[model samples]
Target: MSEHGFWSRFLLPGGLWLFLLFVVPICLVLALSFGYTDDLGRAVYAFRLDNYADAFDPLYIPVLLRSIGYALATAAICLLLGYPIAYYIARYGGRHKHLLIAMLVIPFFVNYLVRTYAWVALLADEGLLNSLLGDVGISEIQFVNTPYAVIGGLVYGYLVFMILPIYASLERMDGSLIEACQ
Candidate 1:
C-alpha cells in the first residue's frame, strides 16, 4: 500500500458524513442552548446564556439534579450491564446468537407507542404486576406511575440504545481476543 493509499481516501467519506450530520447537529444544539423562545413563542437566536442561567433557578434545579443523577447511574449501569452481556454472547451464546439478537430487535420493530402502552398495561394499578403480587401475597411492592416505574420503562426503552452496537461489536470480534482475555 502506498503512503497516499486507500485509507486516506476512505477518511474523506466518513469525515463528510460527520461534518454534515453529526457536527452540524451538535453545532445547532450549542447555538440553540444560548437561544430561547421570545414573548411570541418564536425561537430567538442570540449568544446570551439564559438557557443555562434558567437551569440554576430554584424550581428547575431539583429536577436537574434528579435527571443528572439518574443519567449518571443509567450510564454506569449500562456499562456494567452491557459489558457482561456482550462478553457472554461473544463467549458462550453459541448457535442461538441470531435468535437472541432477533428477539431484541423484534421489540424495536414493534410500534414504539405500542410497547410503551404495553408497559402501561403491565404497570397499571389493576395490571399484571399487581395481580402477580396478589397471587404471591407480596402486597406491598409499589409500582405504577412512580419513580421506579419510570426508571423501569426508561431502562427497557433504552436497552436498545446500548444493545445493537454491542451485538455488532461482539458479532465481529476476533476469536483471538477472547482467547487472550481468558
Candidate 2:
C-alpha cells in the first residue's frame, strides 16, 4: 500500500466509532425533535416545528437564559481561579511542577459521583460543615439547593479541565515575553 493508504487505514476504527457513537445519536435526536405526541400520548414522528417553538416560548425563555447565565458564571469562575493557580505552577513550581499538577489531578481519580456526594455531605444543612458551625453557636446555613451550590459544583467539576490547558499554554510561552511585559 501507498503511505497515504496506510495512514488512512489507521483512521478507520476511530472514524467508525465516531459515526456509530456520536453522529448517529445526534442525528437520531435531531430527527426526534421534530416529532410530536399523538392522542394516546405516544410519540409520533412528524415534520413539525412545535417543539422548537415551545423551547423558545416566553415562559421557557427565562429558564434557557438562566441556564446560559449559570454556564457563563461557571466559566468565569473557573478562569478567574484556574489562571492564577496555573500561572503559579507554570512559573514558580520549579522541579515540583509535576507533583503539584498531580495533586490537582488526584481528586479526579475518585469517581465523579462520589466527589459530588462528598460535596453534598459537607454542604447539607445537617451535614459536617453545618454541624461544625452549629458547634460554634451559629445557626445552620442552608448551602444545598441553591444557585450558588450549582455553580460551585460546576466550577469544582470543570476547574481542572480549565487549569490544564492554561498551564500548557503558559509552559510553552517564552519567559522573556512575560518579563518584558512586566
Candidate 3:
C-alpha cells in the first residue's frame, strides 16, 4: 500500500486514539508533575520544580525502585512461562485454537481484584494447597498476604494477557520456521 493510503487508514485512527487518550494524559501528568497543589488539593496554575524534587526524596525513591524491580521481575517471569504455552497452543493445538484462546479469556470476564482474591483464597492456609498437602503429611503452608502469594496471584491472573499476545504472534508465525529451527 502507498504511504499516504496506509497513514490515512491505519495511522490516522491509531494516531487519533493515542492523541486523545495516551498522549494527552501523559502530557497532563508531565505538566502536573511540575506544579503544586493548593489547599483544596487541586493543582494550581503556578509552575515549580518541587514536585519533581520531592519525587526523588529518599522516603519515596526506595519504594519507587522496588516497584520498578518487581515490574521487571514480573515481565521476565511472564515471558519465560508464557512462551511455551503460547507456542503450544498456536502450533500444535490446531483447529481448536480459537476455542482454547477463548477459554483462557473467560477468566478476564471476572473482575481483576476478584480473580486475584480467588487465588488468594485457593492458596491460603487450610485452603486448597493445605488441604492437598495434608494428604501427604505436610501441613500448614502459609500463602495469602505474602509476597509469594502476591506474585503467584499476579502471574496466574495476568497469564492470559501475556499468553494472548504471544499466542497471536505464534499463530501468525509461518510454520516453516519450526522446521528451520528444528
lDDT of 1 by residue, 90-129 (tens): 6687998778777767888888889999998887878898
Give residue 109's error in model 1 in angstroms: 1.2
Structure candidate 1, residue pairs in collision:
none
Model 3, residue pairs in steric clash: none
Candidate 1 vs candidate 3, TM-score winner: 3
Instruction: Give candidate 3 regions above 4 Å deviation.
Output: 1-18, 125-128, 131-137
Could you tell which candidate, 2 or 3, scores higher by lDDT?
A: 2
Which residue pairs come into collision in candidate 2? none
Instruction: Please give, for residues 1-182, the per-residue lDDT of candidate 2 as tens digits.
Output: 89999988999999999999999999888988999888999878899999999998999999999999999999999999999999999999999999999999999999999999999999998899999999999998999999999999999999999999999999999999988999
C-alpha lDDT score of every prediction, in listed order: 0.80, 0.96, 0.83
- What's each prediction's TM-score? 0.75, 0.89, 0.79
The positional error of residue 128 in candidate 3, measured at the CA in angstroms, is 4.2
The residue ranges of model 2 lying beyond 4 angstroms of the native Cα positions read 37-44
lDDT of 2: 0.96
Full-model lDDT, candidate 3: 0.83
- Which candidate number has the best TM-score? 2
